[model samples]
Target: MSAFWRDSLAGLCALLIGIGIARFGYTPLIPVLIQHHWLDAGDAAYLGATNLAGYVGGSLLAAWLSRLVPVARLTRIAMIITTISLAACMLPWGFLWFAPWRFLTGFTGGLLMVAAVPLMLSRAPPHLHGRSNGIVFTGVGIGVIASGTLVPALASEGPAAIWGGMALVAGLLTLLTWPRWTPQPGDASPGTRGTTRAFTRPVAILLVAYMLDSAAFVPHTVFWADFIARGLHRGIEAGGFYWIFFGVGAMCGPVLAGFVAERFGFYRSVTGGYGIKAAFVALPILSQHPVALAASAVVVGAMTPGISALASGRVAELVGFAAHRQVWGWLTGGFAVASAVAGYLMSYLFDSYGSYYMLFGIGTVGLCIAMLLSVFVRNPPAPAAQAA
Candidate 1:
């Protein structure tokens, strides 16, 4: 394959290896575990929650440690731990064994995201920020799909077999693509003194907005299959299959964002994105048709990338290279904590109420907050004047 393919493939692998545990591995595997009597509902919920905590902790470290550790090294370190921790999956199946590794996996995944996202964007010519980051962010959806699809396919096997197979696949991919990766210029770690605070008002708002988005988004993700299967009375396989549409919807989000931002101002582009996504959050409850699900997903997915790209590009614009890495770390770390909390809350609601309605409610509220947040973030004043 050409360098472009390698670079793309490598970036894709970073996401796959990163969230393979929290997003993909655990959900499908939980069913398998229950069958084996390896885990109870509480065990899985607690473990997934711990994974979120670890992710936040990792992102927090990335935010500050980048001052001393270079963004590339941080990503590389994350990749290494991600690979190693995944290998640990094949080791055993105790609740204690899996939970800590899962948490570590989340931690490393956050670190990788902090670096990989901007590095990929920087590889593009300056203005292609929308396209590069969009593609990278889309990988989150693809990774989500892969996790669900791959886990169920392996579900017939023993839990060990499933985890072992995924670990081998993820670990090999990481090893093969190591050399192809490079950090963006100025993304390198500086000495401790360089870790100055950069919490502009916009940054604070971005952080809060991202956290709310995460809290709202996690429920749909963590329990989508269960909702479809149990709530809608679809079979488990059918429900899981529906999530395929969700992934497709999400994957399209960034591609459309690229086109949208080109046509509209970045701020408007994001506002539109959040607006569509908010509608889609309540869509399943409203339309309730399999076809509507697909349509809703595509439209919702298409809008998200614009907002995310707009957010990142705005950060790069506001803070300049002097502190982009640090700022992103803070914003994304807040997102990680909110996501973890949201996931846990959703699980609690499911086990409590036996419905996905609450998940939809959470999504609705979150997207609305995200929309309001977008309005507050106007164009960063022209760089020349803002730099002072």
Candidate 2:
């Protein structure tokens, strides 16, 4: 295969191990942990939040560390750390013991997410940027699909078995992608840094909207499987099936959103994506009918990554390419902070109320606010206007 494909595959593997397995692989296992008495419902919820918290640190760390370390080297080390964290979780020593390992997984995952895509994109030919991104982010969906399908099958064998299986998969991906990572000449140079004041009115509006999107999606990402399995009494198999639908939608979301953005423009596409996601996220609260649940699963899943792509493009449209990386880093950092906060807050509310309905309601409201905020985001001034 060509170098482009090699880099894309390696990036894909990094994401698959990082966000896919490290972050999301734990979702389906939430029900299993509670069911097996390895952890209570509240502890499981908190553990999930812990990973999100670790992700916040990792995302911030990746930005600073990239200046000091080669992006490819950092990504490789992250994957290795993520694999180790997965293996470490198999010990089954309880919540305190498992929390740190889960945190490590999230940290490494954040590092991969922030570092891996750029590493691949830097090597990609200009014409192939879009296609290469699709290939790389597709790893997230593949990882979700693997976890959603495999966890239930392994659940019968016990949680340790599930952890072992995930570790094994992560280990194989690490080995396969290891040598494919090559450093770019620019990797050694510390690039220009932009100020936070780049958050002009339009950019600030967009950033807030993006942060709300992060907060709104927490319900599905953190609690969907548990809601289906425990909340509805549907069992782990049923939960996994819906999660499979989510995975399928996730796989299609970014590509479909990219096409829509190219046609309709990123601004309108983001607004519509948020509106649609809000409606679907609230669907479970309105009705638990099998069809309603499936639609919710699919649409919300699609919007999760779909909206992200649109928002990133929207950022570029607002700030131009030179500042896009810096602005986008702020955007990403905001997202991680929101997700971490929402995850913990929702977990607390769930523990206090013992209901998933409130969580979905909160997500819906946040997205609705985001949709409104997105409507106010105007485009950047023309070059001539800026110069004047």
Candidate 3:
């Protein structure tokens, strides 16, 4: 195969192991953990938050670590650690024991999330950048599908089986993609640097909106499966069934967003996406009908990754390519921090009230604010040289 396809495939596997299985694989297992008495509902929620906390650490460290180690080497190490963390969970050593492992999983996932895409994108021809990105991110959706479908099937064998199965999948992916991380020349050098001037008013507004998206996403990402399974009194299988719709929407989201952005521009696409996301996120509060729930699952799932794509493009549009990386790093770090905070806060609220409705309501409100913020982000003025 050509280098583009080969590298894209490797990137896809990286995200599949990192973000897909390492980060999101815990959602479906939440209900399982509670059901098996491994952890009570509150503790289980707290454990999930721990992973997000680790993700914040990992995102903060990934760039600095990449400066010390090769990006490819650091990414491979992260993937290996993620696999080990998953396998370690099979011990059933209790919440304290499991919490650190989950944290490690999230940390490694953050490393991969930060390092893998750029590694692949740098190698990809400019003409193929869009397609390559879509291919890579599709791994996350595929991983979600696997979690929803495979986890339930494995849960029948017990929680240990679920952990082991996920670990096995991560391990297989690690091995399969191991050769692809061969370091190229200049792999050790810190990449292009963006000046502080890149932080313009429009960029700040966009950053805040992006951060809000992170907070808004916490409910669906952390608690959707548990809400359906335990909150609604549906079985794990039923929860998994709806989660599959989520996965399907996630799989399609990036491409759909790209298509819309191509026609309407990234700014408008992002604004409209937030509006649509707000409405769907509020759906569960209005009606628990199967169809409404399914629509909610699909639309919210789509916007999870969809908004990321739109926001990334918007950043590039606002700052130009030279500053895109640095500004985007700010955006990502803000997102990680916000997501961690929201995850813990929502977990606590769930523990206190035992209601998913309030959590969904919070997400909807956040998205509405995000949409309004996005609407105020006017395009930056043209550079004098370009205008001349």
Give the number of the best model, judged by lDDT.
Answer: 3
User: Which one wins by TM-score: 1 or 2?
Assistant: 2
Model 3 Cα shift for residue 112 (angstroms) = 1.1
Per-residue C-alpha lDDT of model 2 across residues 1-388, encoded as one tens digit per residue: 9988998888888888898777988999999988889999999999999999899888877878988888888888888888888888888799999999998988888788776776787688888887887788778888889999889999999999999999999999989988876676755322455544456888888889889999999999999999999999999999988998888788788888888998999889999999999999999999999999999998888888778778878877887766666676778778989999999999999999998999999999999999999999856757412522
TM-score of 3: 0.97
Pairs clashing within candidate 2: none
lDDT, candidate 1, 76-190, per-residue tens: 7777777677667765567788878888988887776776655655555665554556666777667656666876677667667777766776667767877866554544453
TM-score list, all predictions? 0.86, 0.96, 0.97
Worst 10 residues of 1 by lDDT: 186-195
Return whichever of 1 and 2 wins on lDDT: 2
Kindly report which residue stretches of model 2 are placed more than 4 angstroms away from their true locations once superposed: 186-192, 383-388
How does each model score on lDDT? 0.67, 0.86, 0.86
**Using alpha carbons, what is the TM-score of model 2?**
0.96
Better of 2 and 3 by lDDT: 3
